[model samples]
Target chain A: MSKVLVADFGTGNLHSVMTAIQVVSSGSEVEASRSARKIRMADRLILPGQGAIGTWMSELQDDNVRQAVNEAVRTKPVLGICLGLQALYEHSEEDGGVEGLKVLAGRVERFSDGLNDCGHRIKIPHMGWSKVHQTCQHPLWSGIPQDTRFYFVHSYFARSDRDSEVAAVADYGLEFTCAAARENLFAVQFHPEKSRRQGLRLLTNFLNWNGEV
Target chain B: MPLAKRIIPCLDVDEGRVVKGVKFVNIRDAGDPVEVARMYDRQGADELAFLDITASSSNRETILHIVEAVANQVFIPLTVGGGVRTVDNIRSLLNVGADKISINTSAVERPEFIEEAAGRFGSQCIVVAVDARRVPDTNPPAWEVYTHGGRKPRGLDAVEWAKRMCDVGAGEILLTSMDRDGTKIGFDLELTRAVSSAVPVPVIASGGVGELSHLADGIEFGWADAVLAASIFHFGEYTIAQAKEHMKGRGIEVCEIIDEFE
Candidate 1:
């Protein structure tokens, strides 16, 4: 049995998230831990978090999950949701300043005033159900159809110019990165678990993906 | 660019359990909130809204237990409503991981609720749910907005009420046709277009939806941001994948579906 580690320290939807994976892969072992550890025992790792970056960082520190996550990401499929994805970046300006896992070469920041200048036509926090624009080719989108609408709930978005890492995007007040991935690490700004069946297919695809380029 | 139509599955929960069917009379076992949520999570449901149906009058606990349980298991965004009358309720739901909260009866009975909730939670977190029934097209004709699950009529024009809600900071509107709900004869497209055009906030066309094509009509022709239905999904008439496929073929942009099963 391929063990899938779902790292949870009282953040976002950890159980429903595990249920999503379980639905696709029959049943995989779900371990909710504040301190990430023992990746050798699992085939993949899921990093799920919901809430502000500052709070998540504090929680991680309180439980010492940072180093354990870094060690596991070295040779595992790690997926992050909402703040979980943000935590993997270099840093965030959510509250004062908080440094992230920085496993990837990028930075997460808040959306700034674009050409419109009035800020985003959409309200701040960019919450709601919006559609995503597929910007790149990645196996995570395998069975997924084009121009699909995914559930999104967030105010700040990640800013990455790596080009190669961005997998999908959505336009609210402006076009922003919705999905990003690198090697064994994959992250989406949108919540796939909350997105229903299409999202489930994405999870199923991820579990069996094999990271085909 | 035309906004893509959304196929949403709504779960009406009573005391943490999901109930379904027309006029809400023939309620059947729709599965545990978390268990059913897992299935929809896999089905690629565009969005899921859980309505407590009686959370208000009963003054029962806001049913955050299911929210906690379901949010823990599902990855997609979750919007919760039903008896959500105050900003604290919205705060509690969001703190518990709900992406958004829907407000109904409260908004009509007291328009201030819309402004207050939107001001405190940000317009994005507030959704105004309206139940409208067509009451013959007179000089102005008229559509009455029903509150308390169609038990009481607010005696307000549906279009006017929608405009008022938007003006007061409603980020989105969940509009349902009382006559068409559960019948699945098709969506009240006429009503959908009116509400969508009247407000800037995204409008979710609810009440009646029979087929995937109906979903297309709701978004394309009806101009709704999302389409909500229960019977089809509850009875297994069409899966979210099939509905999305139908929409995609019609040149609609749907979220990607990673098909690993086939």
Candidate 2:
């Protein structure tokens, strides 16, 4: 029996995340919890947080999840979504420059103001569905085709100095890293839970990933 | 290509049931909220908005149940609005499964409510709804903001009001035009362009949409980030796929289905 724990550390809304997981989990055991022990015992870990990274990090520390998460990424398949993806980086420009979980070697920077795409001004938060281009091969990319449109809503995005870890690319004002892959860790800026069938397919891939690259 | 301009179908629920009309009157029954939601999801709608028009506070529980049921089955962003006044109200809806909270009446009553909710929940999920009607006999032409189901006018300029809402931390604006709502000639492009140009965040154009061309016009001319409609999509007059294809043909970027089963 596979155990999946969605990191519900009381920092962000995990209702949709939990529901989407159960739909794709079939008969697997899926629980959304903040309990540090349950988090460590789970076979797969999903760390999802939104809003500001400062509050997200503080709450993770308050709930004693920071250390547990760092340990989980080293051994199990870990998936991050939205701010959950941003928090895996080392630092961010949000909330006057906050620190992240440092699970990957990158930094999160806010999308510059007055960004124009094909002569039209692009809005901040980069809301709605856009195509996601696969940059490298990973188990998570298994059934889903390349450049599939996924739902995105954020003001900032992440970039890694280590190109090998970059798993996906998306263009708003310019192409940026939307998904990163490093061994057992895979994180995405888009919300797979809300991306409809393609999204549900990605989650199903995560449930059966086995932590392989 | 950048982010696809969204095609969001609005479901006005009264006591947990979905209803449609020409102008929020002569209500016609359209199946259960969950069933309608599922149908839209399967048809590849970019997003779904649930506006509770139920008159009394007693319907709050019913709305919550409807939201939870749809959220569980449909794997997409669910925006729930209608009578959202308190932070606790936002929390309760988000706790159930709402991705975004739209505020209309309460926001007009208290402008700071947008700031408070945005500060607590992040601007990404806070949407300010503006219902406006054109001010006749004006030099440059303008629209005035209305509240209480368009029964009262607040004397605020619609374009300026949208910018102010964004300034106060509103992530998106749902701009609805009362003058052209039931007539269905098309979206108020002049109003849409004015507000879309005034705000820094995304503006979702609502109210007037009769043909597929109106949906494309909202994106192409009105400069709306998303186009929302009712009756047309509810009555099965046009599918979201057909709408997206129409938009794509018009040189607008839209998300298309790529092996939904794959």
Candidate 3:
């Protein structure tokens, strides 16, 4: 049976990630764990984070999950969501410039304060559903159509240095990299746990993947 | 396209079952909350709200179980409210997979709870629900805040309460018009506009969404960031797609649904 470990860094909602994994892949054993030993033993790792960047970084340090996460990403499949995706970058401007894990060569930047395409002033959190355009073929996007709407709630987004690592792009004020993949690591800015059927499909794909590029 | 206006389906739960009633009386069992939530998720609902109308101490565990069950099946944002008086209560709900927690009576009892909860958890996870009624025969014809499921009048002005909630760090306001609720008219446009413009945060217009056009009115005229409905979606009157289509026709930018099943 596939064993999936959802690494809990003590910030944001991790329950939804565990529940979604359980529902989508019933045969797999899913555990929302903070223990480094449990994380290392799992076949797949899900790094889920939320809230302020500096606070999440401090909690990750306090829990000593950084080494465990790095080892897991090198040896097995790793998926990041929301702040999890943000943490994979080099740094973030949130909370006065907090440093990230630097797993991916990119920086997280906040959306510019302005109006949207329709000339209506949008909220900062960008809380709602939006379309995600698949930029390339990836196993995670299997069975899900291009430009499917996914639920997003965040003020900052990722900017990758290498364009090829961008698996999907979404438009808010402008097109931004919403999903990134490098070797065994895949991450998304949207909450797949809250994206409905399409989200479930993505989780199912992740469960079936074999840690390939 | 702009950020799509959200369409939320609210489920009023009593002892683990979805129930609906007029003014919180003569309640009728609708269905299981999990099944209803799963159906709405499949129907392309943007989010789901579960309100424990019976917020009795004995039923607290039951609501949590319902939330857990729904969270397992529904892959969407779930907001749980009622009987959430303390930070521990919010923690318990979030631990069970709730994305947001709505506070009404408790917030009205202690306005500082809004700041405390928002401070502990980010404001994005805290929702302030305000149930208001339009008071006629007054010089300005203002709205009064009601607590205890709209049974008690707190005498707080609705617009001012919304502003205070925002100032205290409420991410969004779920403004429900008691007079328009269950009356099948529409949202209180004036109240919605007043609160939406008063705060920098988003406003979710609730109550009295009778038809598809009413949903559009909530965004176009009421200036709501999201429109919430119950009876119409709970029954077979209309679907979320129909509402989105109507809103799109009215020049509102709605999230496009790419039906993969078809």
Candidate 4:
């Protein structure tokens, strides 16, 4: 009967994600709040964002949302999407290096070069649907197939300090990590709300995940 | 990375309600803006832009009330524009919970409005909306800019106006092709590309979308940051979920679509 809290940072596809959650996890309540102060009471949390890494982190610093996120992740199932995923890192290359929340032990860096050693031909912001190669065991993939397509629109991606944090990898010019999970924390570069069936399945899985063996 | 395709659903509101039309005329009444917004919210729409087509002429209070209702009900970022002529109007829209405020007629009539709004609200909050119609010239055909819901023509060239809007303050540009507006034949790829490449800020392509493939083609060939459509979505011709699925099948990167019925 407890409701799930979706963090609304005044930016991103918060509503789309919340609606998906509501449908996938029917009968459960969903609430959205811009203030991080309201996030602590939720049974779980969804962080959805749309903006540059630098600007999003800047606003978080201005609002002191970092601490609220850190505390929530400690005892709750937290999912980060797009800019929300980038916010989990220690820093980002956006705007010549802005510090992230450091909830995950890594940094968000821009793609260095291109696939096949080709010149910097690919666009910097990786926007669109890409195939995700699952690597870790997370209940969020209950009915989903391996290497299913998910939506993504981001320039920078997460680089975990530990190898185990990566939950899935997506292919672009070369294979890269698209989704990551460390403990109760989970994040994806692609957006689930914008992603169709696979995205809904993922949301359904997240809702059904009981955090128990 | 190829430019990501954006699936944008635009709401045309009259008297604080949603209405649709062809070529920006012969308006047809749709459902409540807030209710429609909630529907799109569930269907995995990438973004929502609320065009206050009648707010400039009357019922400013009703417009804000509609915006507040939709914003409170939906979770995605909302961009509100129509009859916005001053920085005060821009600020008020943002204050009323708009993620961004779009300006068209004002920016063309008084170019300084863009700069002043940008100065006060930052480029992120200010968006310049341009309506362009292809007109024949003695030498080569060109798209002439129109204002006040395509009723008046601005002497300035659209390409030049785009650059000027960026120079003044617009953080983004919403370019709608009047020729394409209800046709759904496809987007004006030339117009979208011209304006997107000209402005440094993000460009959202509006008008002339008949199918899902058109959205893909516009983003890929037109270089649009986002693609906006009205009739296709308003009349249930296409669902956001289906559009996203088809876009994904076409190898375009789109947001994960949450199915409405699922």
lDDT (tens digit, per residue) of candidate 4 on B142-245: 78899888879987788888888777767777899998888879999988887876665668888889888898888778877688888888778788888888
Q: Which stretches of candidate 3 lie over 4 Å from their true place?
A: A62-64, A117-119, B21-29, B135-142
lDDT of 2: 0.87
Candidate 1's error at A61, in angstroms? 17
Ten-residue region with minimum lDDT total, candidate 2 chain B? B21-30
- By TM-score, the best candidate is 2
Error of 4 at A42 (Å): 5.4
lDDT of 1 by residue, B52-92 (tens): 87685443454687887877667666788888877778777
Q: Distance (Å) between predicted and true CA of A47, model 1?
A: 11
Order of the predicted models by DockQ, top scorer first: 2, 3, 1, 4
lDDT string, candidate 2, B123-216, tens digits? 9999999999999999798999999888899999998899899999899999999998867789999999899878889999998799999999
lDDT by residue for model 1 over A103-178, one digit each (tens)?
A: 6667777765332232213333454456777887787888777777666767678877687878788886667778
How far residue A55's Cα lies from its native spot in candidate 3, in Å, is 3.1
Show pairs that collide, candidate 2.
Answer: none
* Winning candidate number (lDDT): 2
> Which residue pairs does candidate 3 place in steric collision?
none
TM-score of each: 0.65, 0.96, 0.91, 0.69
